[model samples]
Target chain A: MSTGDFIFTGLGHAYLKDNWIFRNYRGEAVRGQVLALLGPNGSGKTTLLKILLGALTPSEGSVNIQGQVAFVPQLFQVAFDYTALDMVLMGRAKKVGLFSQPTPADEEAAINALERMGIGHMAYRPFHEMSGGQRQLVIFARALVAEADILILDEPTSALDLKNQNGILEWIDRLARRENLTVIFSTHHPHHAYAVADQALLMLGENDFESGPVGDVLTEKNLLQLYGLPLKRLTFDYEDLNVETLVPVFRNCKRRKAN
Target chain B: MTEKTVKQEKFSACSSGRFRRWLPKTPLARPWILGLILLIAIIGSLFMGAYPIPWHRILEILLNSVWPFSGSESAYLDLREITVVTLIRPPRILVAVLAGIALGMSGTALQGMMRNPLVGPDLVGVTSGAAFGAVLAMWLGFLYTPVILVLSTIGGIAAMLGTMALARVVGGRNDSLPLILAGFFIGAFFLAGVGLLIYLENPFYPKGQRTGNIIYWLLGTFRGAGPVKAWTIAVPTIVGGTVLMGLRWRLNLLSLGDLDASSLGINLNRLRWILITVVSLMVAGQVAVSGVVGWVGLIIPHAARMLVGPDHRRLIPASAMLGGLFVLGLDNFTRTVIWSEVPVGVLSAIFGTPLICFLFWKTKTKGWNE
Candidate 1:
């Protein structure tokens, strides 16, 4: 079963006839790989993500998915005041019987998932009361307990602060590299893609897309074309370590240091 | 983490996973302990009516009615007190308890399914439809039979179907607002029909002749509770409550909205309809047996959430017990404390609307403390 973990080609969707959101999109994800999707707002990144998650079907193409796929939606609020443990335990929905309550074994597994996320101490705490980072990690713990082979995250770290963003990126890397789970996340950050992604897909237009290794695909020229904003590959040394980061060089910034 | 200490945890321990939340967290409010308290409250209520009866005489009356025993306590039992406790109080208390349980359970299931805190069974128009059906049956001269109850159940289901179909015509299946608005209109329509039927039944007569019976029933009092009425409400509540309680965990997921729940490999359509049908059936039973006991279906679930913290496994049972207590307390207030009988449904609306206002103010100002 090694003909690429999954592949989709010529995928396109439109809410109305001839009003295509994105088209001619194709990508392949393998096990132990993190694929990042980059696009501007209204570029149908969410639509493409929905297609990959099998929640929505592409009008023109097909996604051949393999293994159990677990989806971690973007930061959200629950209507009820469910506890953190209760939130994680809902991951067992696929495992628990229709008429049966969750047994001690299931409860133990949920607790372990929370513990693995390092938020076990907040098990009994209300979910809505938790911070955005805590909630995102709780969703990650839910995905882990579901025993998913593929993880689809929709802008997982877009709403978090810088620290939580990096924390989420680290977990995404770890889940793919160590857990051997294929991850595909959609975000607006090109640097996030450069930092963690093996391959990047940029949806430029309805029929235009760029896909390749992160190095070749996330070039300054290509990102500038994709976002209509120039992004430079800046190199700097931090703590005696050679590092590179992408920064958008906005044209509106004041050129002179002092007036 | 917020200092919301659950007063319902000891009772919450009767459950499994979250039930254990009570054992290590809070050390009181066990199920049997609460059950004992409920029993005492119920027995204490029996002695509360205008015609007072002592506890021992009440027990003797119950025993002599059920048990063929040679006891000297029968000598002390008076006919009037025995009639008050056995014939009158038992059925009234039974109806109140069963209706409360039904309303509470239905409210929890509904709130979980709708994923909105403001949702209630009465909001969906099923109660008014059932009320119309009962009134229609009474108008057709089947006032003292089970026909009204049967028609009431059918009417509730029919009204819900109409609400759905109307919503489908307008908003399709995905939007939640159409369904709610459709329920509001359909419920109002049926309530108007109920009013028309009542007026048509006795146009020239004054209020008290035949209209008094219809008007009293419409106000929803337990003044005429009997074995027949109590059993009618009990059958659907027990059956539907069992099905709903079993689905508590699934409801926690279903309430996560359509997208994530579908990702979880659950069939949302089948689950949603099952919940609707069962909730409609239980509400229909309450409305049929005791005319539209208004706010228990709206109020009890929120109160239970404050106590049990929104885990449906604990919330369902806790709301149910609280429901019975709330309605029973209201009935006691009207029957004993007041010189004249006030309707339970009316009393519940008076209490429920204020609670809603308080909740709105609290949630609005605090923002769920996010």
Candidate 2:
């Protein structure tokens, strides 16, 4: 099934008595595509994602989802220790009966997902003992084992080093293409979105947002307006390799005065 | 090249493969072993009272009771011995087993639901609330068993609801810190109320009478066990335990926190309310009969987890059986070893504290997650 078909009309949310965070937001994500939601802090990106995951009810408007959606949270803090395999097996909750335990087949699927992520060896390791990036990969494997066609990730690469960030983004791109899964992930890095995302959603403010093909919605003018900062798009080509970069000008900020 | 080398190294370093070989192939094996142990403990406990019955007679009586059709009524068996062995001992042992099962299952559910290992009936004020209710019933001269049962059930449910509501109001939905704080406050409030009741009753009753009642409420005992009391604790414990066991897999999901559980297609509000209701019933039933038994709930599940990992499927049944064994063993020790009959609650703490400390130390060294 092409599970990424989602349409939101006039989506809005307001918290704490009439203070609107985002209102009248409209967007659509096609099947088998990756939509990158870009915004700075306090831009309601997380709220929008929650609304899509159906964890939060939109104050106005409706959202239509074509298939099951699995959510990969940014981080998980467990009070008790669970193994990485145990964590991944939790994804089979929807498939198993409420009273029934996970079957051997389910265990096989969890192990397969971990192997797919190149972390099968960590299956029995305690999740809390693993490094942040490794835990993030386990979370990804958990989402994969859910068998959902639509994967929603909340800032999947926010707190990772360079190699780990690239690894996660590369996995997302490859998974979307190989399995025809639809993915929506939020990120602070615009370059990462440019590298992998097929579409972009830019949240400018409480009432203003933009969504379209990545090439159209992620232009220098749109990002500059989104962050209210000067940025430049640079491209270079050499020996059949092309590189694109979005660099901040960093000239507009004034030096801080001594307190 | 480094990534490939690291992958190779990790493949060889997978310790779970070694661990899996030591674990039972089926989940039911450990629980069955524990059940056998409990059965042996029960039979052994029957031989321990002031009127000592021989083991051979105890065995013959048990066998004849189960197989009445078999023509093997021993002519040598004394009527008094039969009465003590069959009639007197079974009810008390059944009560202890049922109470242990209730506390262990409830503790597993609450700890999983709250996602805190330290949480128990006492931590959540359920025991204290029930204690207050039972103590108040005694103070009011309503010494009827049914009256105390009803009042304690209501009190336990009320305290849990109050704690949950306080947690919600103070810190959004089911935040752990606020819930624990609310439990501590509510528990303390009810415990003080119990103390006040004891003080008020001191003048009307003699000092010994008042003190004994208060001690019974604080340190649980099974001396009051009879057929009626056994059924009172057994029926609810069986029903509630079956329900909790049925939802064991879901309980595993609940430990992941609310949002993750919901995202996985669990109805969080519905499941939470069901858990709270069943857990309250189990705790109230046990508390009404045995007074506020502490630490059996807390320590047994932790021990079970050490044996059976954190999967609720194995953990729940293992906990229940181990709890039965632990309480039965302790009660046997209380009746047989000590000249004075010490309350099981007091003995549990005396023994449970050091074991819990050891468990904590072991968990810290081995890593709880491992």
Candidate 2 chain B least-lDDT 10 residues: B13-22
Query: Candidate 1 on B1-370: residue-level lDDT in tens?
Result: 3333452442333455543564333321233444465677787787778776666777777778778485566877788887888789888888888888888888888888877676677777878888888888877777663677778877887887788689789975445688789889999999999988877775445555777788888888888888888888888889898998899888899888777888777888889888878888888788877887887887888777765567788778778888888888888888888888888889889888898777767668545335
lDDT of 2 by residue, B99-158 (tens): 899999999999998887878888888888888887887787776666777788788888
Q: Which residue runs does candidate 1 get wrong by more than 4 Å?
A: A2-4, A234-244, A256-259, B1-32, B50-55, B73-81, B140-146, B158-183, B202-211, B358-369
lDDT of 2: 0.83
Candidate 2 docking quality: incorrect, acceptable, medium or high: acceptable
Worst 10-residue stretch by lDDT in candidate 1 chain B?
Answer: B22-31
Residue-by-residue lDDT tens digits, candidate 1, A192-249: 9888899899988888999878888889888998989999998999999887779987
DockQ of each: 0.48, 0.45
For candidate 1, the share of real interface contacts preserved is: 0.64
> What CAPRI class is candidate 1?
acceptable
